[model samples]
Target: MVIELYTYPVGFIFTFFSILSLFRLKISLTIKFGIVGNILYCLSILTSIPMMYYFTRDTPLLLLLLSRISLLIINLIYLHKLRLKKREITLEDESEIRKTILNLGTKFMRLEVREISEKCGFDRDSIIGVLKKMIINEEIYADFFQTTNTVSFDQQTNIDEIDRLMTVYKDWEKDHYEKET
Candidate 1:
């Protein structure tokens, strides 16, 4: 009885952490498997109630074994997904702000909106407008240097900025290229 109660909570804790780790790691397979495994493990753990009621005794070993097996299967599937080929980003799919921020980060060692516009040959006003939207969306942190009129973005900021830019750029490029060709 004591063992069954203890193992139940421990299993729950492991399942919870596994789910959180999957999200933090950004591993899509891990996230999927973890969610499925946690659900199964939770059901198996709940079965302990029936097991005790029917046998009038503890069933720790059975519950522990089932939880472990579910976790093991999830891990295997996650590893398999990692071994698959990764997709590449195409120029037509690239975001303007994201690409511009990345280039500026590399060349100037800083991701300033103004510098990104100049480096990427994009209009300053347009870039600022896009950046404002990103900031509102919580995609980027637009830190204004009031004295210098400069805005800087961190690594995640660069990624967000680029993602937004690419989305807009794709639409514009589609029309422009269609017109030219």
Candidate 2:
């Protein structure tokens, strides 16, 4: 197969411009138009391939235009779904953290601290301090393996002890709030 020197490079230039337009366009309508423009520009690359195959054939310009239009429509729908999925996952993560905090009676799990911070929008240092205090007070017991830097909480913590710990946390939150006001 013979290679055309200009075909791929021209296609690549159009592709780069299309990507820039997709990011730079602000208004939704303008963005949609930009996406369509990008698709049409990319479709030109595909036409170049067919142009090589049938050197003498008159390629239908309308067909290339239609293909680009269809591709743009498909991509818009896909982006909408992706945005919805991201929102749903965020809600689910928040719900999960709330449930875990309630059931565990304190946000002191070594393994889950990072996730808790993300879910609750807390700083890492604050989470570490809370966990450290819980460990120091014997409110929760965690076994740390120094060699592996791994820690696991005791699964057999008594319900009564957890209830008492949660009550203390609730009282502390009330006092903290009052102080802030």
Best by TM-score: 2
Residue clash pairs of candidate 2: none
25-125, model 1: which lDDT tens digit per residue? Answer: 85664555465556555555565666664776666756665676677677667666654422222344237665565455534434455666666665555
Candidate 2 lDDT tens digits, 10-35:
54665566566657763344445546
Candidate 1 error regions (>4 Å)? 1-94, 102-112, 156-181
- Predicted structure 2: lDDT: 0.56
Weakest 10 consecutive residues, lDDT, candidate 2?
1-10
**Native RMSD of candidate 2 (Å):** 13.3
Q: What TM-score does each of the candidates earn? A: 0.28, 0.30
Candidate 1 lDDT for residue 110: 42
Steric overlap count per candidate? 5, 0
What are the lDDT figures for the candidates, one per model? 0.60, 0.56
